[model samples]
Target: DERLGLVQMAIDEHTWLASEAREGETVELLVKSHPHLSIVHFTLNGADDVLRYRKWCWSGPMFRMITMGRCGDTEAVVARACRDGADLDAGHFIMGPQMPDISSSAARSALAREDIAAAALLLHPEVLLWCREHKVWQASTEPLRRDERLKHTNRPSGTPQQPC
Candidate 1:
């Protein structure tokens, strides 16, 4: 009966979230509305419904959401996952390989497409460091370094280049 109860609860939550929740309400608020069920779903079942809803609502994966970066929804989802003790790094690792390689070209391509979020994420300092440390792509560092140098050079003598 307990197991059945959980299943029913999950179904109910899914239905409400899918059909009844307000347009701008975040997944975190919805999940937090039923903490025990959320914990069980996230911890025991990998929060499949949440992931599914992310895909359905955003039309992409978490990484894609991050790349899109239009809405703060992706960040909120990540924060909630971290608060709930989800393996954020694991999600990153799983999604990493599918991402465009951390290179200037990739960043430029994203920019050309007007995907500023994707470009920013690709050229992020941490991502640049990660690529260098992990040898994901040794060449990624050069363009970033060049860009930094250009930033400094372009600044007036008395003005410091703003950090990204």
Candidate 2:
């Protein structure tokens, strides 16, 4: 399976990144060679430009490249990547547990607690949808559920809030 092979290569590259420019070039080459390679999961150092490879998974190509060629636009890229290939149910791959639909409720919650910027780097669908739904850019706030809880608290209206 070329897609599975691509996933393995991404993982291997993350494990051993020698030169900065060279690593970037390597990743770029990967993208070019495998247009369907879309999923990339990884860690990173403080410097944004440096990515500490974790693990990656991808699908083939899609009707359009939702996130291709744009530096710093990982979510679109990943979603587009997932959309690229023929559908592969979770059971289809030998990779670890079914890849979470980054677009689901659970993933969204996890992303909220995570650094928004870092989550954005991963661009998992759950996080992206949450960000979009919340209109996160104008003002940063806790997730909608949290906000709702705060709005409907049963505490005395004028009482100073007690520690939980």
Candidate 3:
């Protein structure tokens, strides 16, 4: 399996990427060998200076480079916006589980608690217990379960979070 392109990827010189479109089952791509490969994903809508096409819209609000050429008047602006966006990067990807959206009652109950984020790992009791045996989240100060017994005996260190 590959990244669904739900998150757009980056491509540079001599690089390529393929993904399924969000709208329907279709593949959209472009290939070119330019004297100067300044290729990047950009809005090709209303782009007349595009080397080959006047406009390209296989998927509305889509991304992926068409080709490399001089659209410095417009492409330059898009490139600058990309740069500004990068400069505003936060610690989002640094310290968090990168799990996909979980849509269960567990998500709601856990989120209702203010300190749930304090748990390094959020899992059901059985899973959390397994993690403990594997040396995961064994040293957190956040309670793993509402049942204090779940915290006391099975804890690998016999020292679970303080206030269960």
Candidate 4:
């Protein structure tokens, strides 16, 4: 019951924070709850990490929002967070496939008929990959960047290439 209470409280507070734009205060609250805040930017960046954390209740919506470009600071936060071992747990987070929020019964029922392609169209590459890996969507490989070019020359293992 106590655990349930905390979950409820956290959900309530999270909703309030997002709706109210009380970003600073919400971030402070997160920092206070987790010790990693000391060495980490626990506000926005950690929020992405949180999205990538399966243990967190906000993962699904948050990940979806971030991937959909619906969140305010998701890009900046995620970029900054990567400098500090974000990838270390990134795979773990995606592998588990967190459950979507279903507290709103209507939404839960609606999801029964939801289309995976539509959902995938709204997600980031990482989230798209996660969804595909989990069988929520059929995987389609993203095209390589046109500017992403490489150059090489034929050479033997024991010799460097001569001038062309």
lDDT of 2 by residue, 5-123 (tens): 22333354466633332224455677789888774422221111111221123222211111112234344333442555523343221122223233333334445565466456555
- Write out the backbone clash pairs for model 4: none
Candidate 2 Cα errors over 4 Å, as ranges: 1-103, 121-133, 136-142, 145-164
Pairs with backbone N, CA or C atoms under 3 Å apart (clashes), candidate 2: 61-84, 62-84, 67-77, 102-126, 103-126
Residues 1-164, candidate 4, lDDT per residue (tens digit)? 12222233335535553222232444467677886755222222223344454223333323322221214334444554455444525432222222342222232222233544554444444433433343431222332132221111111122221211
Question: Of the pair 1 and 4, which is ahead by lDDT?
Answer: 1
Which regions in candidate 4 have their CA more than 4 angstroms from the true location?
1-70, 88-90, 93-164
Model 3 segments beyond 4 Å from truth? 1-98, 103-153, 157-164
The lDDT per prediction is 0.37, 0.35, 0.32, 0.33
For TM-score, candidate 1 versus 4, the one ahead is 1
Better-scoring candidate (lDDT), 2 or 3? 2
Q: What is the lDDT ranking, best to worst?
A: 1, 2, 4, 3
Model 2, TM vs. native: 0.17
Better of 1 and 2 by lDDT: 1
Candidate 3 per-residue lDDT over residues 61-142, each given as its tens digit:
2333322233333454334434445221231111112233332334334433533453224444444334345432234444
Question: Whole-model lDDT for model 1 versus the true structure?
Answer: 0.37
TM-score of each: 0.19, 0.17, 0.16, 0.18
Candidate 3 lDDT score at position 108: 33
Using lDDT, give the best candidate's number.
Answer: 1
